[model samples]
Target: MAYNFKNGRESVGDEPRSGRPVEARTDNNVQRVRTFEHQDRRITVRMLAYELNLKRETVRKILTDNLSMKKLYAKMVPSS
Candidate 1:
């Protein structure tokens, strides 16, 4: 039996043994979130995920990990 490092197990020449699960959102979500942030609305993580077509976790990571992105998101919120 040959070892398939790509996904573990044997490879059937070129076909995938199984299909991977699809993500709920696409790259378009990133654009949408940026747009919303520019509009000056307090975008919650959940709402942004739904409207932007991204997973809540993904959006959270993007906002937290990227400084520029976080800054852009911050601009959307109004000061209390």
Candidate 2:
């Protein structure tokens, strides 16, 4: 960040990269994860990942960050 500022970059935000942007945490995925959770709260992160063709970490993020959910007693439940 300091280097970028010294190089005359105007903002602190990240610069655009060359490759395609990540789309794992999209709204569609979030909704799909939520629907799957509602259909079967006992679904595990690995199972969700396999079923949705997403990464385990991505599924976990959808559950914990997007859906505000956590694992409890081997089941997914709302954090609050």
Candidate 3:
């Protein structure tokens, strides 16, 4: 905070950041998830996320939205 004041920063809000936004939902990732699911139908979302180095929410989204799957009896099952 002191450094910012010395540097003549006017506002206290966060500065504009530069870099590409994180995009976990890509065709390649989706394909990889699908392949892993095929190999093991009982894999957990946390395991999948850790294995893929992606967020758990991202893995869940891929399972539900992209793959149309849902949890049943603590296992991933295809939604009707």
The prediction achieving the highest lDDT against the true structure is 3
Model 2 residue 59 CA deviation (Å) reads 0.5
lDDT of 3: 0.90
Q: After superposing candidate 1, which stretches have Cα over 4 Å from the reference?
A: 1-28, 67-80
Q: Quick one: ranking by TM-score, best first? A: 3, 2, 1
Instruction: Give per-residue CA lDDT, model 1, range 34-70, as digits (tens).
Output: 6776664576778877876678787765555431444
Question: Candidate 1, clashing residue pairs?
Answer: none
Residue 9 of model 2, lDDT score: 85
Local accuracy of candidate 3 as per-residue lDDT tens digits, 17-64: 889657789989899999999999889999999999889999999999
Model 1 residue-pair collision total: 0
Per-residue alpha-carbon lDDT of model 2 for 1-80, expressed as tens digits? 57977888898777788985687799998999888878986788999999999999999988888888878877778987
TM-score: model 1 vs. ground truth: 0.45
Give candidate 1's error at residue 15 in angstroms. 9.8
- Measured by TM-score, the strongest candidate is 3
lDDT of 3 at 69: 96
